[model samples]
Target: MSNFAILITRRQFAITATATSRTVAQRVYVGKPDKISNIRPLAILKNKNDSPLETQLKELQMDTQQWHHKFWMNHNKMFSKSREEFDEKWFAKKQVSSSNQSETTKMLEPEDMAIFHRNFLHNNLEAQRTYDREWKTRNKKLLFLSAQVAFQRFYFKWFKSFFSRKS
Candidate 1:
């Protein structure tokens, strides 16, 4: 084929592939009484401010890293549960509930569930990474605050020097 003909063929394939894929508008789906292939729609959070949960958490100083660690470590009893409950309830059970089901049956081979596991593991790792980064950031701020609170080396010197400099 000529170079132009090859270009045209490639363009045709690009157009076809793009056309076949779902777009954002299609995200608002008319789901069948059937299995889902993609993400479930999220409920809109109409009111962003003043959730009861946030208020309760704040009263417990949950924003502080130590408090958060203590709260989670204590409250997440499954953290030290038998391995089966830990795996079955927290990890594998998520896939079962998240999967779409019909009136009578659910899809067995809708997609290989390993992809879901792969995605979940990837997400879990990313979340842990972000959590570590935030903890480091918070620790830096706390360290700076402690230094400001306890260190007065420059304060007395600056105050005494300011008057002398004017003279």
Candidate 2:
């Protein structure tokens, strides 16, 4: 076939394939009821006030939410240190006051400068690693949160369209 004819054929084939794939992926819904008279319609109750049961359930739900909020807050505080707490201990310069000297520090200082140097280097390296880890973790959390929101929106749109077509 000529190039023009071949291109036309290929385009037609692609369009056909896409339509076939879509039809195949779509579910064939069956057994839809014509009327649901037994179950009360939500629209009928729209202008009505809340029932006592519903009011009690809503109050209980709110209480549960508050309890969960307080629980998580206390849990987080127990497990995690504030930035101010970390900075006060690690970043602040220590006083060279004689009254604050521990017996271990005094012994270590006199025995060898190499031991003190090694300890300082080890602590410095550990702090650096901790900071790097926290930085990466925060970035990862941000990326994950963004991806989750995008995925949920996509799923919501797809399901909405699919069900709307069915009905």
Q: Which candidate is the best by TM-score?
A: 1
* Model 2: ten consecutive residues of lowest lDDT: 38-47
Lowest summed lDDT over 10 consecutive residues: which window, candidate 1?
17-26
How many pairs of residues collide in model 2? Answer: 0
- In lDDT terms, how accurate is model 2? 0.40
lDDT of 2 by residue, 1-167 (tens): 11111111343232111111221221111221223212111111111343444344334434443444454454345334442343334323354344444433443333245644465556556655765686566556545654664465456668988999999
Off by over 4 Å in 1: 1-67, 74-78, 86-123, 153-167
- Clash count for candidate 1 is 0
Model 1 reaches what TM-score against the true structure? Answer: 0.29
Best by lDDT: 2
Clashing pairs in 1: none
Candidate 1 global CA lDDT score:
0.39
TM-scores of the candidates are 0.29, 0.25
**Could you give candidate 1's per-residue lDDT for residues 42-68 as a string of tens digits?**
212222342444333333332453444
Clashes of each: 0, 0
